[model samples]
Target: MDIIGFLKSQFLCHLFISYVFIGTGLIINLIQLFTLPLWPLNKQLYRKINCRLAYCVSSQLVMLLEWWSGTDCTLYTDLTNYSKYGKENAIVILNHNFEIDFLCGWNFCERFGLLGSSKVLAKKELSYVPVIGWMWYFLEIVFCKRKWEEDRKTVVQGLQNLRDYPEHFWFLIHCEGTRFTEKKHEISMQVAEAKGLPKLKYHLLPRTKGFAVTVQSLRNVSKKFYTEGRRSMSAVYDSTLNFRNNENPTLLGVLNGKKYHADLYVRRIPLEEIPEDDQECAQWLHKLYQEKDSFQEEYYKTGTYPGTAIVPARRPWTLLNWLFWASLLSYPLCKGLANMISSGSYLTLTVFALLMVIVSVGVRRMIGVTEIDRGSTYGNNENKKKQP
Candidate 1:
């Protein structure tokens, strides 16, 4: 291995990285806590402050995918609406496939200047997790319990709350509701069959009620008050992502500095173009997924989606933000390591070895969290449970 690859493979380097990420994440979360008071005083200023703080936290993961692993994420998009990518509010639809799909999503958000303010309709259980989850609460990321009866009100209120959000953010949605697996796909198609829906070859049936609610809340807003001038329009970023050579990527692969090239095909659709009525909206969403399946089929055959492909300019902010954290957090960690070594003490060295083993296990658990096998059982038997 070369010097860089050898360094990346070192236990000490991984330790330093994990320490910096978790350490700075906790620190930023603490700072986010102080913004609660600012929320009541000046909500917009509070939002702006939280945006930058959230950037400091989320960009680290983006750094892992883009900078450390050196993965290339290319965008295939309409050149006409390309300039407006980072300038407007959008509801982004993404495929839930690979373990590192969200990391790739974060990579695009970083490039588009939306990393700090990107939102997602994540599961409510994630709200309790440390670091990213806690930081997301301040960013106003919408969370759901996956029950239509309970989540309808929560999801509606969440999307409605973003009416006058200060930053141009992307509210990302994975309508499939969980990462794809052969078993999940098997059951998902059974549900699709029960509903008299066509079988999908590439994706599971999309959950539509939350999407319908999101559209009504953000789509038809009456002339709203100004946040960078009052044009009440929200667009849909219909995005389909796939990897080159059909590579199944994982967070572990990324952490170990393995690179994967990703291609994301996006089409910008105006919310006005979609039906406003809930039932109609749901139908529109299902049809959109059908089209998305076709896109995936094309990608599988041609290794490209149908589009005028263009790569957006990569910004240096992710790298810079990571460097800033590493510089700040590494000093104390390295100094202690140096002192421990120079002392020539077995006890301290033994303790360090044990700590490495513990961290290795912790890292494995973290990677396991992103594995497809560990994904939620939301739709695996929903149709059967509803039946006799």
Candidate 2:
């Protein structure tokens, strides 16, 4: 492996990267705070500026994935619809199975020029996940409690806030609500049986409440993008992604201590036809999962999905964007701080450090609190094991 890949694989490197990403993210967020006074004057301009700032910070990881790991990403899509990807606002429905699916989606957004404003309806716990989570806060990404009753209103409010956003964006939603596991799949299937819906072999039962609410909330305001529907928009929607097979020790994986295949599947559907009724939407989502399950089965059996094409991953301007901000912002901030400390502003420095520590701790605690532990069950083994 190359030196960058080697460095990425080391445990210390992991920590270092985490720190760099988080620290840089915090600094950028702070800069964004400096723009609060501008919100009243030109909300659109302020938002656009924030998107550029976000691009700078987030591109570091994208660079890591694209260059350091040397992983390959292949897109499968019809060429007709490639143009419309980042030109308008849209909702992205994705299956939640892999740890890095969000990263892949972000990569695609970057390719289509939507990286800066890309959003997701993520579990609230992800909001505390250091760099990425911290970055999402300023981007106005929606977070959900995953409890339908409590989340319904809050999530809708969050989505509504994006209606007037000046920039185009891709709002990702993992209707499944959690990463897939064998046990979770079984439990989801039981929920399916209880609801008299078809069981999915590849995906867990999506918490329809989230998908339903997302569509209902954003339908009037945002266009819906399905993996299959991108062609209709004249935007080439790529459906395949190359992931480092964590199960197999690629040189990169061995170094990085990651153990899961970076499997990705994407399709595009248009926004106009999304069902309005929650129940119908739920059934449609379940059926889609069943179809996806069948696709996975075929893929495993044949070592390729049924699709006929391979589309190369497109590298975006995210790296240059990162470099631009790092050069422009980091030096000025450092020099300013040095001057402040030299001028007897030690107390100010101390207070800033203390505030950083407090915010870090608070964010960490919030993450810990929001995570759902599915292992514990309230019933007997057989019944408990069947529910998640």
TM-scores, each model vs. reference: 0.94, 0.74
Worst 10 residues of 2 by lDDT: 228-237
Per-residue lDDT for 128 in model 1?
86
Candidate 1 residue spans exceeding 4 A from truth: 227-233, 342-358, 383-388
Output the TM-score of candidate 1: 0.94
- Model 1 agreement with the true structure over 113-152: per-residue lDDT tens digits: 9989889998888788888789999889899888789988
Question: Best candidate per lDDT, number?
Answer: 1
Steric clashes per prediction? 0, 19
Error of 1 at 164 (Å): 1.2
Distance (Å) between predicted and true CA of 145, model 2?
A: 1.9
Give Cα distance to truth, residue 249, candidate 2, Å.
8.9
- Model 2 alpha-carbon miss at residue 211, Å: 0.7
